[model samples]
Target: MPSADRGVFSLIIINKAGGLIYQREFQAGLRKLSTNDYLVLAGTFHGVHAITRSITPRIPNSQPPPSPATSSPGTAPAVSGYSYPNPGVAVTGIDYLETDKFRLTCFQTLTGTKFLLFTDPMTGNVDTIVQKIYELYADFVMKNPFYQTEMPVRCEAFDRHLGAWLRGRT
Candidate 1:
């Protein structure tokens, strides 16, 4: 299981366009931002991520060039660009994870799914916690017949299970 040391600061989810889809801060004493500001940040980040992906260089083909005499005549080659397993999202970057008091975990799903989990920077096995949260999201949010994609995640069961699991671990 992922670590649960109460060092988490916040989590943010961004859409393909960098719109702030979700933002939540868990730790105490951190400065709070208005909902509008958080949304702006999400959008800005999304734009930057897309720009970064476009700027990334494409890998060149590995095949050696054929000699003129042996070369096949006039076959067009497919052009490709630098590609990462995109998850249909522009970019998923974790800016801050380790600090004196907190750590951040960011997970992006294949359909541009994004999950950001914060924890104690010193906590061990944070991945486990992340996996469990993801599972809960899948079971409660994605699996629910009522959940609409790109909408705010508001399942009561999700909140309950998340609180229970975190409390238990802590």
Candidate 2:
């Protein structure tokens, strides 16, 4: 394992279906886990995230009482509440998880693909790193003719660009 002083530790990409799509280790500070363990972790996290989102309390909105004329028999009126974190923005599950040893940041794209980034607990600019990783995924993985959506990322260009970007950062 590498020293804790290093900024990044590893990354894990889970598809919208909770399948492990990508896994990479940027440093050696974290203990090694088997591939099966990583897959189990991804699935477990996905389930927990879903539950968290569903159970999130939404802010109530005030509205005038419905008039009898507008009310229809045996029909329920539509009711909604302001979303958590923001009103207009759609809900994305847990943003990040922090422990004494490391911080795990999760960035889910509009299409539901998630990027899990692991960094040292003291590291900064995590959002910037995640956004850059998203850009690289778009450019290299999405643009590759042979690549399939929501599939395991096997693009050489993606690996090269990601490594270069992180190397440049450090």
Candidate 3:
């Protein structure tokens, strides 16, 4: 079992089609889940993320319109913008979900790949960690010629680099 101070518990990567691409447990803080259970969890989270994105309340455009030079022809922006917290940015589903035991931090790439990081509730700098994980994925997994798109990640380098990076964090 992992010590109480271990910050990260696990990481789950989901493809654009809601398939589980990669999953790793950094610390044995949580009970072990079966392979099927992990797949189901990935699918369920993907559905919930879609629902959350769809249901997010769009605030009306209260700010002034872009100037003539910036404004495109016949392309006025939506009256009700989808982005929350930022107007121009597109809506990515729930960024962080916190519970008494742990916090789930999600980071979605522009290509729709999602990184789900499970960390201790008290863990800080989760965003930075997620970003670094994404960078590692891009470098080790995506860059590998043998890697197929939207498939399970089997790259040894990705696994090695990710484990090393997480270990350095604690």
lDDT for every model?
Answer: 0.66, 0.86, 0.88
Q: Write the per-residue lDDT of candidate 3 for residues 65-153, one digit (tens) a residue.
A: 56667867888763432236676778777889999988999999988999999998888799999999999999999999999999999
Which lDDT tens digits does candidate 2 get at residues 1-170?
A: 44446687888999999999999998754689999999999999899888888887776566655666888888786454444657677877799999998899999887777888998887889999999999999999999999989889998999999999898887
Ranking by lDDT: 3, 2, 1
For lDDT, the strongest prediction is: 3
Compared with the true structure, model 1 gives a TM-score of 0.69
lDDT of 2 at 143: 92
Worst 10 residues of 3 by lDDT: 76-85
Q: For each candidate, give its TM-score against the true structure.
A: 0.69, 0.86, 0.84
Q: How well is each residue in 42-73 modelled by candidate 1, as lDDT tens digits?
A: 77656655565566554444565555666567
- Kindly indicate the candidate among 1 and 2 with the higher lDDT: 2
Clash-forming residue pairs, model 2: 2-28, 2-29
lDDT of 2: 0.86
> In model 1, what is the error at residue 134, expressed in angstroms?
1.6
